[model samples]
Target: MNEITLPPVSEIDWSTWVPEQVATLMFILRNDEVLLIRKKRGLGAGKINGPGGRIEGDETPEECAIRETNEELLINPINTRFGGELFFHAEDMPRIHVHIYVATDFEGTPSETDEAIPIWFKLDQLPFDEMWDDDRIWLGHVLQGGTVEGYFTFIEERLIDQQVIFN
Candidate 1:
């Protein structure tokens, strides 16, 4: 098998880089359990992730977060608050900037949709192996009430480099 080669992270000028698309990721935390989803379609199809999607016309990141969660899980996030931001740079695909939110409560019950399948996991037992590589690096911080800013570089679906700052 031919080995996959990736460009050095330094080659990408992050200082002036801008994301082509803006999105959101919302997680509902109740006690020790966090709600996640098995995405059935879209960019990260087949990966386990928070419920979120691209920002629709004129909607703010927070609004998009709430809207997407309701659409994908049939629930409305309550007491939602901004948690962090993530910047992704992937080879050949548009760069993306994601706003992260955490909710302490939610209205309605989580149900499966064409877009995703809702799943809840204990805080200490997140299935990182089935999630985006960058998730494992910064998700713990968010769960612990810490805010973060993460920059990730990917070559197709492979994570090649990352940096995260907790504040």
Candidate 2:
């Protein structure tokens, strides 16, 4: 038997090392509003984002997205479509990648849950200023029907440089 040796902490770029599998709901509300949440934990906790969570167990990312939305905001993600993936890399965390999604429809009214507070925002009223800085750079591009995969270098939680491959 062989033991798998993990990389030394000193070799891991903690500043940019954040590998995550995340699903984001693009729940379009009745009045051209988008359902968003104030996350309670993780990378974007306390900032506005769509309902989602890390992929767990044998569940696929799509399943995780729907389950997370239900668990976090008590909403049923209906007519959900796989919007595709987002791959991000940073120099601080050189060995991890992020997978992101955008879903289209959902059921039930948005409400606050222990993990998040769901709210509806008009299409033009997105609160980009209160979110992670990288969001403003790519989130809009994703919502606008573009596919994205990129690498970024961050220092002290601030992005210093990025390279995106959009399709």
All models: lDDT?
0.92, 0.65
Clashing pairs in 2: 13-92, 16-92, 16-93, 17-92, 17-93, 78-106
Residue-level lDDT of model 1, residues 1-167, one tens digit each, is 55556555567777898899999999999999999999999898999999999999999999999999999999999998899999998755668999999999999999999999999999999999999989999998998888999888887787898878898
Per-residue lDDT over 1-167 for candidate 2, one digit per residue giving the tens place of the 0 to 100 score = 55334443335564565565444444434455677888887666788877776677888777777888889888777766555454444434333355566656667776788789877777777888876566677766666667676555564455556656677
lDDT at position 7, candidate 1: 57
Q: List TM-scores for all candidates, in order.
A: 0.93, 0.73
Candidate 1 clash pair list: none
How does residue 58 of candidate 2 score in lDDT? 84
